[model samples]
Target: MKLLLTLCFTCALLITAESLNCHVCANQNCSTSTSVACPAFSVCSTVTLLRRSGTSTTVTVNKNCSTLPSCPSLLGSETEWSVNQGFAREARRQLCCITNDCNMRTLAVPNSVINGRQCPGCASSAESLNGSCNATVSCEGVEDRCFNSTTLNSTQLMIRGCISNNLCVLQAIFGDLLSGSIDITCGAPCSYRMSTLLLTFAVAAHKVLL
Candidate 1:
């Protein structure tokens, strides 16, 4: 009887050890779903990014286990994380939960509202994409920002577009993570037509990497 009790106790411990699980996916099909045992003391998270330019919009979602601290949304009760990348003319939202399989639900993407703001817009990479801005774009929703992003010892990336006002508040929450290599500066509407000169980021890096 003693041996049997010991075996049963061991089995219970094993089950407890394997209880934590989370879903994992990366910018893949919205219908696709899978789950795996989460690492010890980890929480399930979901990161959703929405990119819009011209008249087109795209959605990207990523779900997985994260050890990062839970980010509570201050803007609203349901929305946990949101950012308007004025530089790249993109927007993002995130949700984080601790309950098992809590991240399985789909999140609603907010609609863009034109706020009469404008800024330069363009995209460039080492590879030939030839992204350019013919003119400034009208800002909508929370997109009332002008942003600049520069990489260190690498290609220069610029995003001039409308961004949400909440983005500035969110940036403060991340003060613990910013580094010299990566800098994001955001402000108000820019000139009607603005463009950035492609240069070795080694020089621009000096401006932000203080």
Candidate 2:
């Protein structure tokens, strides 16, 4: 019984060692005998398994290894990626205006001049018809004028614009990384990378709100 137990322990240790050993293949095409291995970035084609009989034997086999889809390769876990993407998408949506009324506008007359002033004719053809005003009566260049007629408030517009601009800038900087423009580097662990990016985003957002 003692001898049998020893044999079983030895066999278990050998199996554990074999399982722990990671033999990365060099060539895209690899066999059990080929010692060369592919780099970390390259796709793995097959994994070699060793069988211990009277003598150790190498077993060559093909494996169905799937590659990760191309996306912004931000260093983070899946949850981090999801949160960042959600924030970015929301910011973009807030920034973009589908209707003509709520869109951002540049004003010829500053907010200081138009505040608390009720000049209906200020935006009427009557002003153009009169000799007093030579310019067209349109709300084209004025942000305050645009919002004055819309359901949104000045503060809301400002916040939306700020958030959207920040999101766009970040997206532009990390677009390639997110869109899988670069291959995944093993050195930048996903969790660490995500924390750093999220921290930067949060800081920027806080500053903007302040």
**In terms of TM-score, which candidate is strongest?**
1
lDDT values for all models: 0.53, 0.24
Residue 32 in candidate 2, Cα distance off native in Å = 24
User: What's the count of clashing pairs in each model shown?
Assistant: 7, 16
lDDT of 1 by residue, 1-210 (tens): 999967855653454354567788733665566787787656567666676544567777777776534443521134522333333335546666556776666666655665555755443222112334334556655565665544342544443344465555555442222222445577655444233543446558877897
Tens-place lDDT per residue, model 2, 1-210, is 999967855653343332121233334434222223332322222222222222333333323221222212221111111101111111011111111122122112111111221111122223322423322211111111111111122221111101112223233322332332221111111211135778899999999999
Off by over 4 Å in 2: 1-77, 82-173, 177-210
**Candidate 2 TM-score over all chains jointly:** 0.13
Please provide TM-scores, in order, for all candidate models, with all chains considered together.
0.54, 0.13
RMSD score of candidate 1 (Å): 14.5
Q: Give each prediction's root-mean-square deviation over alpha carbons.
A: 14.5, 28.2
Worst lDDT run of 10 residues, candidate 2, spans: 86-95
